[model samples]
Target chain A: MEPIMAIVVGLLYAAAIYMMLRRSIVKLVIGLMLLSNAANLLIFTSAGMSRGAPPLIPLGSALPDGPVADPLPQALILTAIVIAFGVLAFAVVLIHRAYNIIRTDNLDQMKDTDT
Target chain B: MSLEVALPVIIPLLTGTFCVMLWRHNVIQRVLSLVGSIALLASSIWLMVSVLREGHVVMYMGNWVAPYGITLVGDMLSAIMVVLTGMMAVAIAIFSLSSASKSHERFGYYPLMHLLLAGVAGSFLTGDIFNLFVWFEVMLIASFALLILGGERAQMEGAVKYVTLNLLSSAIFLSAIGLLYGITGTLNFADISVKLAAAEHTGMVDVIAVMFMISFGIKAAAFPLFFWLPASYHTGPVAVSALFAGLLTKVGVYALFRVFTLIFNQNPDFTHELLLWVAVGTMLTGVLGAAAQFEFRRILSFHIVSQIGYMILGLALFTPLAIIGGVFYIMHHIIVKTNLFLISGITHRLLGTYDLKRLGGMYKARPFLSILFLIPALSLAGIPPLSGFFAKFIIIKAGIEVEAWFVTFVALLVGLLTLYSMIKIWAEVFWKKLPEGIDPTPLKEGKTSGSLAVLYLPVVLLAACTLVIGLHGQPIYEWAEFSASQLLNPEGYIDAVLGGNRP
Candidate 1:
């Protein structure tokens, strides 16, 4: 299961990097989104996925009774997902503004600020 | 649990929230911000005093023990950074008073600035890796809004590149944090150091180290990863640019220094060697890049990269003296770089442009302003009896002592090149006569000299700081030494943070 997930993560990274290399700004945003998801999955798989009992410990015990799912990576992935969403939203709006003003989604055309 | 460790972050955060409410009343907002900045400075100074008097101060959030809950630790290094951040906040806040456009103020510039300061303070003081990521985002979002506040075409374009690269770095940083946590099962910095020591698979740690390096390197504007910096840094207003130039990238370097020294020390020979080469590359490329730029701010932007190289070089040296030099360089660079930007703002206000080819006669016209500029400019170039000289001297001396002759040569060469570029700015913008067609505009032409005088205040203060540090170098060096010693021995940090409870 971990090996399959690792392959999926690798393919996602490859696709994302390819899109990121494109000159179109829209593709860049899409690339960023994909890269973010790929990163989340990497964290998930690298942590060694466990589909087992809930992470909650019994009231009287200080530890879980049996094999338990790791909750830390899930919390981390959720946080990353939210932050990625906010950043992606902002990136889209920024690209939209750039397109409206500079009249292009092409990164090459956006050279006005460069010396 | 000392609450003073938390005040540097808390004060600015509360001020930002309140200032947001008074956005329409610009005067009120400014007054509140100025008072808030003063409070922040006071708190930071207080924290430093306590840290110096007592050893490392740790504050566990929610009263939870370290290694299980969030921790805010203030060793001397963190204290110094907080103080520096406070100083920048005060200077930039005062400068923004008269310099910022009314429209910019009305749209909550002060609040965002305060929020940015909060993020910086938080980053400096946090003892958790995950917490550091959160602070970086906090700084990022505020900086993004501040970058595009005016919504000009160039700004939008620059913000696009800036935001894209920064978001990518954040993603990478988050991924690294997640991976690190997955491997170690702890987010606390000290605990991770402990866990990584006992954990197997050193290979994964090395990979994550590189990932952390790339993330921070991009932020610190290292070679091969610094395109976003020069492309966007000069696009903002002078106040915004000065704040960014002063504090933003330094935060990245601070992160690198912290992460590398604390958590990644397990494999120094490999990691520090890689950083040594990166330092050399960053220094040469940055200075060479600066030599090509004719614009005042653009040249300064490149120089920021060059100076970052010097800081990282000290870190890569990986010795007590070298880390001290790095810490001292951070203190000096923050002051000098910011003062230089503030001077550029003054020049822009008076000369009506940033292009060196079009501008002239600042020395002849405003001798006082020229002297102000010369202080920081010469200091930046590492002229003797100035802050940069002491900073470069210590780092180069440390390098020579270690017999890392190649890095020392690169450091010296970069110093000379930095002097060359500073000379370029001075010659083009000041020494040469006003261009034939350029108007010899008086400093008091449009705005009241009162407001212009306000703009000069921070410049004078920062320049004075450089002069004082240069002349009175012993205490600062001692402080740097103490901080460096603290950094060299993570045992003290772990004991202070974990209270000797080894999990």
Candidate 2:
């Protein structure tokens, strides 16, 4: 089950990369959204999949010997998700402003400023 | 107190927040920002002295131990960089007081500037890779705001490319961090070094290293990833351009120096060779690009790329002297490059154009400005008795010592072309006859008050420091050598964080 989840996450990353290569501005934003999700998933999957029990160990209790999911990656991924969300919001507003001013969604048309 | 270690970051953070509140009162914002920048400069100087005297200083947030929490480390490299950033910030702040237009001033420019500075200092002083990424975002967001602060058509157009490329780099950087954390199971840089030392997965480590390099390379404006820089840098106001040119990309270079020397020392052959080629290509392409530009700001923008090659060349050599050379080059370029940009600002205000072909005979009108521009331009061209010459001399010496003949040849050739570009600007903009229909009356009409002179003072002071450091290069050289030694040995950094090796 864990391997299947990893495969699904990998496919999301592939789809994100594909959308990122599109010429339209809207697709680019979607691509960034998908890519960020894929990154979050990558962090989640890399810590090893566990289904046995929660990572919390009660005080005054003997440590469980069974496998437990690593909480560190989850914590890291949560932080990353918040950061990505902030970045995506900023990117979306920036692209919207760009579209409004330049009056075009084509990335190729936006290439006029490159010297 | 050791609390001085955090001043560079804290001052700017507080000032940025303050500026947001004082956004309506332009005068108060300017005055407060000026005071804040001066305070930051003083603190940075104190921190530099403390680091030089006491050696490496590490500050862990909330008393958290290394490998378990975030740490900010201040060594000589970061200390020097912080000082440089402070100096540039203060200079640009002073310049902006009188130069910034009503629109730019009203839109929270002071706050954004300080925010940008805080982000830069944070990125430099951070000891953890993930924290570095966070600071990169901090700086990026501030820059995005500042870039479009004008809302001009050109600015908007430039912001799209600038923000897009930067966002892409940020994404790449995040992926790299995720990969690194997965492999090492620790975000602390010092611990990662120890873990990487014992790891057996050389191939995977190499892949991660490339990811880090590409991400930073894009930010640093290295050859293949530098297209966005020139396009955007010229579109902003002078203060913004000066600060961005002086400090931003160097943060990227600083990160490259930190990561490559500390954790990724496992595979030097592939990484170093690739850097060498990039250095050569960046230098050649940047100079040729400058040669084709007739506008003053555009020419300066291209020079930023060309000068970056020198720093990258030092990294490629991967020796103590070469690294020292890289550090010194960073300091020199920040001061000299920024002075040139500020001088361009002065010229633009006086002449009403940045185009060299449309302007001339400025030497007679503004001799002080001419001198200001000449010193940095000559320094940039690697003339003897200036900081730029010594920077190039050290790198070229290191290259020959290592017997990297091709890189040495490219450095020399780049220096000559740099001189050509400088002389071209001088001949056209200062020596030729002043273009008709342009009033020279601005110089004669305006008051030579101290307030107006205050703007030029920062650049003049920076240029003087460049000359002073060049003539008295020994102390700086020694400091760079000391920092290089610390960087080459990660044990001191690691022990400070993880509290010595665990049994």
Candidate 3:
């Protein structure tokens, strides 16, 4: 199961990188989103996988510390997700404005104006 | 533990939020920002003196232990940067009061500026990597808003490139943090330092170092990643451009100095060589770019990239004296560069344009403004008995001592070219006769009073600071040496962060 999860993340990362190499502005935005998600998953999986049960113990039950999924990575990933979401939203609006003014979404066409 | 140490960050944050609430009352908002900036400047001075006497001061949040929680560490380097930010903030606030139009003021420009200051100060003072990331976001968001506040077509275009490149850098930064955490299982810088010192994974360490370098290199406008800077920085208002010039790239250089000296000093040979090559490339490219420009602000924008190369050159030399030179260079560049940009603002208002072909004979018109421009321009070109000369001398001496003669020669050449560019502006804009069909009478009549005078005040103050720092170089040199020693000897930082002698 751990190896399978790693393979899945590897594939996602490759796809994200490929998409990031595209020319269109919107696809590049989606590429960044995908890349961020892959990073989050990579961080999550590196802390080790869970097998037995959820880490939360019942109210009066004896706490078992043997093998639980690490909670810290999940918390970090959640924070990163929110922050990346905010950045992506801003990027969307910025790109929209750029397109409206420059009248194109191609990255190469937006050459340095001074030249 | 003193409140003075924290006020540099706190005052800006509080005032920013308060201004948001009082946005309708323009007078109240402006007063709040003015008082806040003044108080920040005072506190930064106090904090600098205290840190100079007491050494490094660490404040752990909520009474938590340093390793387990976040910490704000105030040393000579951070304290000096805070003071610089405070001073720049106050100057920009004063300039904006008279220069900013009603529409811009209505859009909460002052509040955003304060928030930007708060974020810059926080980034300088933070002792944890994650906390630094948070501050980067704060600064970026405020800068984003400030860039687009006018909603002009050119501004929106520039902001797009700025935001995109910065977002990509942030993503890379987060990935580096994740990698570091995955290996060491800790996010605290001091804790990670100790762990990394004990670890034996050389290959992994180099990979992580490169990741950190690339992320920071983009922010510092290093070679290969500096295209976004000249594209975007010229589009902002004069005050915003001035503040950005003074504060933003220095934050990246400061971070590079902190992390390399503290956490990644084990393998200096490889890292220093790579950084040296990058520095040389950055300098040559930046100066040539500056030489190609004809506009006032665009040339200055490219020079920011070139000057950053000098700072990185000092860092890449990896000697104690060299790092101290880097610190001095940072201080000198911040004040002089900001003053030069603000003077450009004055020129724009008086001459009605920034193009060299269109502007001429300003010396006969506004003697005071020409004097203001001359001092900083000469200082930037490394004239003797000025701050820029001393900074270049120290770094060049360090480079030669290390037997990097080729790089030393290249650096000197860059300095000469920089002087040529400066003189081009002087000859074209100030010395030559006025261009045809230009109404010289309006500038002559309107130069001495109103909004223009207010803008000149900040430039004058900054120019005075450049001269003073140049004249009194001994004390600043000593402070920079002490700061560099603190960085080179990472034991103190590690002990303070991990609660003393963890081994």
Candidate 4:
């Protein structure tokens, strides 16, 4: 399960870099989404996978009876997801603004600031 | 035990909430922000005093113990950083009140300003790596909104690259944190410092260190990764630009200093040595880039990268005096660079442009502003009797002591080139006459002295800071010496964080 997840994370990252390198403005957004998702999955997989055991402790017990999944990674993942979502939402709006103002969907055309 | 440590984050968080609540009343929001900034400044100073009296302040969230719960640790370095953030906040709050346009006020700028401050303070305070990510996002989101608030065409253009590149860096940072946690099985800084030192997988740890370096490097705007900064920083409102210039990259440098000094010290040969070469690249490319720029703000933006290199150079040297120099460099750079940005704003106000070619005759028209500009400019160029002189001198001396002769030579060469760029702006913006048909009258003409005084107040205050830090270098040097020791030895930090949270 760990190896499979790692493969999937690698694919996501590969795709993200590919998408990000494209000149089209929209691909960049897609790339960003993939990149964040890859990072989230990387966290999930790298922490070592467990079966369906929850992070919760048994009632009145200080510790779980069996090997429970690591809860901290999940919490970190949830935080990462929310932050990435907020950033992505803002990025979409910004890309829309760039499109409207720069009058082109090409990232190449956004070079007005470079000169 | 940790109440003061919490105040820096809490004050800004509460104030930001109030700014949001008073969203409809722009003037009131500005007043609230000013009051809140003063409160934050007070709290940060109090935190500094308490840290001086006592040693390392640590707080665990919800009373959870270390290695399991989030921690906030205030060592000497983080304490001083919070103080700097508070000072910049107060200055920027006052500057924005008089300078920010109606549309900016209408668009909830104060709330975002406070939010960014909260994130910056939180970043300085947090003891957990993952928690640092949350704060970084908070800062990034607010800065993103602030950058494109006006939605100018060029802003939209600059913000795109800025947003995308920063998002990528955040992704890299998040992935790095995840990997580190996997190896150490702990998220707490001190806990990881202990565990990773004992861990058998030394090579993997170095890999993660590089990841951290690359991500934080982008945030710090280092060489080859600094393209986003020069493109985007000058597009924002002057208040946003100045605040970002002062606080944002310094936060990145702070993190670098913290982690490299604390958790990543096991392989200084790999990490610190790498930083040494990167620092050289950063200095040369940044100064050369600035020398080529025709725009006033762009040159300043490029110089931010070069100065950042000096700070990292100090860190990379990894000696007692070098670390002291690094700490002092950040302190001096933040105040001086922010002051320079504020001066540029006044220049923009007077001349109605940021283009160097079109700007001229400020020496004749506004001698005071010219004088204001020269202070930070000369300081940045490493002129004597200024903060930059001490900062550069300490680092270069350390570099030579360590026999990093090439780096020392590059440092001196960069200092000379920095002078060239500063003189370029001084010549074009002050000595040369204004282009034909240009009125030298400021855009906001006939303003009462009260409002005009408001405009000059923050710049004057920061200039005073530069002078004070220059002339009275002993106290600040002492503070940096203590902070350098703290970074060089993290046993105390680890002990406090691992000692468990106490009331």
**Quick one: best lDDT, which candidate?**
4
User: What is the C-alpha local distance difference test score of candidate 2?
Assistant: 0.87
lDDT of 1 at B321: 88
Task: Write down the TM-score of every candidate.
Answer: 0.98, 0.96, 0.96, 0.98
What would the per-residue lDDT of candidate 3 be over residues B391-472, giving only the tens digit for each residue?
9999999998989999999999999999999999999889888999887876678645767777888888998988887888
Indicate the worst ten consecutive residues by lDDT in candidate 4 chain B.
B443-452
lDDT per residue for candidate 2 within B1-503, as digits (tens), equals 26767889999999888888877988889898989999999998988888888787888788777777788888989999999988998899889988888898888788889999999999988888888988998999889889988777678778877877787787778778877887888888888988988889668888889889899999999998999999899988888999999999999899989999898988889888888898998899999999999999999999999999999999889998899899889988999999999988888887889999888987776777778788899999999899899999999999999999989999999999999999999988888878887777875556577656877788888989888878998898888888888887877777866775431
In model 1, the runs with Cα more than 4 Å from the true position are: A59-62, B444-448
lDDT of each: 0.90, 0.87, 0.85, 0.91
Among all candidates shown, the one with the greatest DockQ: 4
Tens digits of per-residue lDDT, candidate 3, A1-115, equal 7688689888877887787778898887887888788778777776666776667766787985566666776777888888888878887888888788778888777765433
Model 4 is docked with a DockQ of: 0.86
iRMS for model 3? 2.1
- Stretches of candidate 3 off by over 4 Å are A1-10, A51-64, A67-69, A112-114
Whole-model lDDT, candidate 1?
Answer: 0.90
Tens-place lDDT per residue, model 1, B1-503, is: 69789999999999999998876888888988888999999999999999998879999899888887889999999999999999998999899988889888877899999999999999999999988998998899889989987889989988988998998898789778878987898899999999998888578899999999999999999887888989899988889999899999999999999999889998998889889888999999999999999999999999999899999998999998899999999999999998998989989888788999998888777788889988998998899999999999999999999999988998899889988998898898889988898777564365446888899899999999999999999999999999999989988898899986787
- Model 2 Cα displacement at B29 (Å)? 1.2
**What TM-score is obtained by chain A of candidate 1?**
0.93
True contacts kept of each: 0.65, 0.40, 0.29, 0.84
